[model samples]
Target: MSRALRAPMPDLFLGLISGTSADGIDAAIVRFEDGAGRLRADLRLGRTYPWPEDLRTQLVALGQQAAPLTLDDLGELDSRIAEGFAQAANRVLAEAGLTAADIAAIGSHGQTLRHRPQGRHGDGRHGFTLQLGDPSRIAERTGIRTVADFRRRDVAAGGHGAPLLPALHAALLHAPGEDRAVLNLGGIANLTLLPADGAAVRGFDTGPANGLMDAWCLRHTGQPFDRGGALASSGRIDPTLLARLRAAPWFALPPPKSSGRDQFHLDWVETALTGHEAPADVQATLLALSATTIADALRATQPSTVRLIACGGGVHNPALMAAVADALPGIAVVSSAAHGLDPDHVEAMGFAWLARQTVLGLPGNLPSVTGAAGPRVLGGIYPA
Candidate 1:
C-alpha cells in the first residue's frame, strides 16, 4: 500500500472525464514510460460510457437553468455524478486488466456543471468554473490517488482554465518546423494553434460545436446526437439562420475567451430561429455554424501552413468534416488517428499525462494557451 512497494508511477495512469455535452464519460488507461529522458505516453485502451438518459437531462438542465436548485439538490447531483465517474474508472481498470495499485494516479476532469471562466473567479469570487466529480469519492472508491479540480488552480492564477489539452497537443502532436492546428469539437469547439517556428500557442473556444446541433437533434429526432451528420446532410442550410447565429459577440471576441452551455443553449437557438424554418433545415444550418466557426478560428490563427488535424466526437460526423474541409480550400483536414491517436480518447489521454505531471511536481498548464499569468503546477491530489 505504500509508495515504495507500488508499481512505478511511469508504468500506467488513468484519466476520466465527461465533456460539456453531459452525454457520457470517457475513460482511458494510458502507458507512460521513459523515452530519451522524457516521459512517453501511449493510450493503451479507452471506452465511453454514456450517461443515463434521465440523469443526463437533469445535469443539462442544472447547467444553465435560470431556476435555482436547492443546496440539497445540488449536493445530491454532485455525489451521483462522482459515483458515475467512479463507475467509469472501475470499468476502465477491468477492461485494461489493471488494478489501482498499477496506476500512479487517476486524473478526472469531472462534469462541468457550470464553467464561468472569467469575471472575478477564484476561492472568494461569486463566479468560478465548477467541475462536479468528487475526487475524494474517486480516490476512496478506486483505491488510487486522484488528481482533480485541475481548472480552478489556473483560474485562481488569472487564467481561463479551459481547453487544457493543448499542452498535450503540443507535447504529442507538435512537430518541429511545421505549423499545425488542433481543433476539438466536443460539445463546444476550441482551436489550438501550433506554429512551425515554435511561437507561443494560442487557443480559444470557437463557439457552438456539436452542442447546438446535438440539442437540436435531440429535440427533433429524439436521439442524443445526429449520427454522422445524417440529419444535416439530408437537409438544406438556411443562410438567414446562419447569419443570425454567427452574430453572437463571442465570434468577434479575440483569443482567451471560453464558453459553455450557458452561451449556446436551446433558448439561444430558439431566439435564432425567428422565421419559420424547417427543423431539419435548422439542423443543417447548425452543422454549417460549427464548420464555419471552426474554420474562422483556424483562419484567425493563420498558421504558416493550413494543416488542420481535428479530434473529438465531431470528427466522426462526415457532413461536418466535409463542411470544414470545404470551408478551408487547399487545406488538408485529417483525423487525429492519422497521427497515432484516437480522436475520442485524446482529451482523456491528456488528463492522464496531466495527472502524471501533478504527481511529479511538474507544470501542467500552458500559460500561452490558457492566458494564465504564468505557468504553474495545477490540480490537487486526493490520495487513496
Candidate 2:
C-alpha cells in the first residue's frame, strides 16, 4: 500500500452497468486520483436509473434463455440498451451538475446476455461472452468518449473474461498485512483473494448471488426482488433442495470460472425442486445456496482470509449477509461500506477505474485471475 498523500486534480469518469438482474442501469460518476503508487476513487454521485419495463422484461427473458432471439432482435436490443445507457449517463451527469465535457470517458460494462467461459463442450476453447450496449452508440449519444466491450478480449486470450473487478478491488481495498477477500455479490457472486504476502491475486465466480433469488422472488411474489430478503427470512432452508443445488458441476470446477443467469436461472432452480416445498422455502434454499457456495469457495481457495468485504446489491440484503456470515464462522464478514466504499456502486466504480486504465493504455485484466496469456489492455475506445 502506498502512503496516502493529498491528491492533485482528479479525473472524472462515468461508469454504467446493468447486471444480470436487469433491474436497472447503475450509473456512477467517479473521481480518480493516482499518485505515489496509489490510486483512489471517490464517488461523486451514484444512481440507478430504472429501465423501461418492456425493455427490461425483454432483457430478462433473453438473459434467462427463456426467449428466442433473432439477429434482428439482437441488433434492436443492442441499440435499445445503448440508448438506455446513454440516457442513464446523461441523467447522472445532470444530477451531478456536470456534462460530457467534464468526464474523461464513460466506461460501460453493458448488459451481459451470455457467459460461457468454458465453451459449450466444457473445453477451454471457443469461449465467448456478450455484453450489449454499444460504445459507439453511447459515445454518439452522450458526446463523451466511451470504453466498452471489456470482457471479450480476455475471452479471446483464453480467459474467463468474468470477474474483471479484481484488479480494481486490489487497488482500492487490499491491505498490506491483512489477508482480505473481496466478494462481489451481484447477480452472480465473485471473490477476489488478496494475500498478505503479496501473492498473485486470484478471483472467480462462485455462482448465483441475487440472480436466482431475484428471479425466483419475482416469479412467486410478483416483486422484482425479496426486499430486505424478508420472503427468504420468513421461510426455512430446505436442506435437500440445497444439497441438489450445491451438487452443480460448475461449483466443483477449479478456479478461472464464471457463470451468469444463463446457467443459474429459474429453470435451473426449478429442476432441483422436489415439488413438495413451499415457494418461500425454495427462496430460502436459494439464498443458502449462494451463501454456502461463496463460503465454500473462499475456504477452499484462501483459508487464511480473515476479512471478507462484500459489495454489490446483495450487500443490502440482511438475510443474505447474515447467511454468509453464518456460513463463514471465523471470517469477519462486512459490507464494503466498512472500508469507505459504497456497496451498491463498487462495480460501477470499478468500470470507472477500468476506463481510466484503458485511456492510459494500461492493462486491466489480471492474468492470474482471468488465466489470460499475459497482461493485455482490455476494451475498445470510442471517441466522442
Candidate 3:
C-alpha cells in the first residue's frame, strides 16, 4: 500500500486543562500520529500555572455544592482562566520550537464547575455538566483554532460526561500484549483497564482522590496542598475512619460511573468527620481513603494478572503511593512515564490528542468508557 493510502500521522496540537482541583492550569503541546491500531504521542512541551489565590478561592466556592455566585463572577473568572491558559499555551509553543500558527489547533478541557451525570438534579432537570474556560478567548489570544467543551455532547448522548481520558488512555497506554490498569489520581481518582488481549476496556471513578485530603490540609494548615504528602505521612491512618469512608454508596457503584467535587469535596469530608476526629487524623484518613478505594476499584474492575500504571498529581504523594502499593500486593506499580509519557502532562496531552482526532474527523470518546451511545466526534472548534 502506498504511504498515503495507509494511516496518516497527526500534526502538533496543544491541550489546556484546569482540572476539578482548581489549583492551576496545565498546558501541553503534543505531536500525535496513528501507529498500528493506536496513536503515538511526542510530548513536545508542557507547563503549569498556579491560579491566583483570590481566583482560586472564588473558583472553589463557585464549584462547591449549592454555593451561589453571580453571573458577573462566572463571566469574569472565565476570561481570567482563558488568559492564563493562553499564556501557558504560548509558553509551551515557545519551548517546543513552534508557534501557534505552526500547530493544528488546541484542545482544551476547560475547568469543570459542576458535573451531574444521572440526568437529574436537585431541582429535577436533566443532567448537565459545565466547564468554564472561554475557548473563544484562547483562540483569539493564541491565534490558533481551538477545540473545547468536550463533555456536554457525550452527556447529551447518555454518557456520564466524565472519565473521558480513557479514550486517550486506550490509544496511548493499551499494552497490546498484556492486560493493564491505568489510574489517574487527580482531584478524584479514576481508573481505566484495557484487557491485555485488547478484549474490552472498563473504567470509572474510585470515589475521592486528592480533593478531600487537599481541601482538609488547606483548611487546617493554610497550604494549597499537602507538599509531598508530608502532613499525611506524619500522622497515622485511622482504620476505623477509613472503613466508614469506604462505605459510601459511590464505592458500590459498578464501572462506567463517574464523580467530581460534587460528590467528593468538602461537604463529603465534613459528613464523614461529623466533628469527631482531629484534623490531622482526618487528613491521614483521607489519604488512606484515596489509596484504598483506588486499589479496591482496580481489583473489582480487572481480572487477576493485570499490571497497574498510575499517573496524575496524586502519584507524587509518596504516602498515597505506598498505601496503594501495600493495598495491591504484587501488582507492578509504575508511572506512565515508563511508557514515554509524562505523569503530570498525560491529561493535557490527552486533550491535545483528542483535538487532533477532532480535526481529522475521528471519534474522540470511547463509548465503552464514557458509556455514550456510540463513538462520536468530540469538541467544538473555535477559529482564531
Candidate 4:
C-alpha cells in the first residue's frame, strides 16, 4: 500500500511518546513527505495529557533517591503506562479531526525504565535500556499499526540508544546559513547541534534538567515540580557544591552518550551537598549544575555562532533559562517556538516523525549521533 501511494511521499504520520520525566504522554500528528536528507512536515496537531496522579507519583518516586523500586513494581508500572499512552493517542487523534484510520502508523517510544548502554565490561556487560509502553496494546487500542521499543537495538549495536531525536532535530531546525543547537530540557537535558549546512548532527544527554530539580522540590516543598524555577531562583548558588556536581564523571564523558535517573538522582544531588547546605541553596546549585553542564556540552562542539532553540519543560523555567544564557555569552538562546515548533511538543513530535520513518522504511537513528553500527532502521512494529 505504501508502495502504491509512494509518489516520493505520503500524507501524514503520527508519533507518540512518554519521556523520562513521566509527567504525561504526548502525541503529535504530522504530515511529511521526504525532502533532501530530511522531511517537509506539517505539525497538524499535538496535545499532552497528564498521567494519573497515582501513576505519576509512583514513577517519580521510583526515579527518586529516597525510595527505590522493585522489579515487580517496575513491571506493573510499565503496564499502567501503556494504558495511559493509548488514551493519549486517542485524545490527539480526536483533537486533530482524525482517527486511527487517518494516520499512516503510530510511532510510540514507550516509557523508559533503565537506560544503560551495552557492554559495560568490568562494570559488567549489563548496559541495557528499557522503555515500557506495550506496542501491542497501543496498536490494539488505537486500532492503528504501532511502531515502538525504539532504543535497545542501538545499545545492542554498541551505541547509547538515546538522544534519538537528533535526526528530526536536524531535519526540522538546521538553519541553512548559520549553525544552530536544539536543547531539550525534559526530565534530562539533551542537545542536538546542527551545523550551518544541515549535514552533520551531534547530540547527547547533558546530565540532569527538571528530573533532579523536581525531585528536590518534592522532598523539600511537597510540590511535584518547582513552578517556573521560582524556588531555585530564590536561593543562592553554592559554588562549592556546584564544583562537586560538575566533577561528576558523566560530565566528562564524550558524546554518543546518554543518562537518566540512574546517573542523576536526588541521591547524587544530596551527595554533592553532603556537608550541610540549605535546601534552597541545594536547589540553586542543582539548577546551576544543569545549566553549566549543558553549556559546557554545547561549547565542546565548538560550533561558530550557536542559536540555541530551547524546548521541553525546562524552557519555561526562567531561572534555568537565565542561567543557560548567562553561561554561554556568545550563544543566542531562544525557544523552539521561534522555529514554529512548540517547546512542549518538540520531542513528542520527534517520535511522531520517527513513526513515519519506520513505515516509510527509513532509518530513524543517526549513526553519527547515537553511535549505532550504521543507519539501521529503528523500532518494532505491531499491527492492530
Candidate 2, 278-377: lDDT as tens digits: 9999999999999999999999999999999999999999999999999999999999999999999998999988899999999999999999898888
Of the pair 1 and 4, which is ahead by lDDT? 1
- Candidate 4 lDDT for residue 11: 62
Clashing pairs in 1: none
The models' CA-based lDDT, in order, is 0.85, 0.92, 0.83, 0.82
RMSD (CA, Å), candidate 2 to true, equals 4.1
lDDT of 1 by residue, 1-384 (tens): 988997545468899989888889999999877666444678889999988887898877765454477889778788888899999999989998888788889999988877777654424355478888889998988998999999988888888888788888877777776788898989999988888788887778889889888888888999989998989898999998899989987789887878898778888888877658888899999999999988887877673656889999999999999999999988889999998899999889888889988998999988887788898788999989
| Model 2 CA deviation exceeding 4 Å by range | 1-10
lDDT of 3 by residue, 1-384 (tens): 998797544378898998878888888887776766677788888888787888788777665664676799779878988888888888878877887667889999988888887755533258788888899999998999999988988888888887888878887788767788898989989989888787767778888888888788888999978989889878887788788788987789786788888777787666666686777788889988988888888887685646788888988888888888888998888888888888998989989888987888988777788888988888899988
How well does candidate 4 score on lDDT at residue 239? 93
**Clash totals for all models, in order?**
0, 0, 3, 1
State, as a TM-score between 0 and 1, how close model 3 is to the true structure.
0.94
User: For candidate 4, what is the TM-score?
Assistant: 0.93
What TM-score does model 2 achieve against the real structure?
A: 0.96
Better-scoring candidate (TM-score), 1 or 4 = 1
Top-down TM-score ranking: 2, 1, 3, 4
* Candidate 4 runs further than 4 Å off: 1-10, 35-38, 65-74, 118-124, 197-199
Worst 10 contiguous positions by lDDT, candidate 4? 118-127
lDDT of 1 at 306: 61
lDDT tens digits, residues 1-384, model 4? 568775443366777777777778888888776767766767899888899898887777666634676888766776788788889889888888887768778889887767778444525276788788778888888898888888877777777898899888887877788888889999999988888875678888988988888888988999878898988988999998889889888788788788888678877776656667888888998899899998888888745756999999898899999999999998899998887888888888888777777777888888889987888778888888
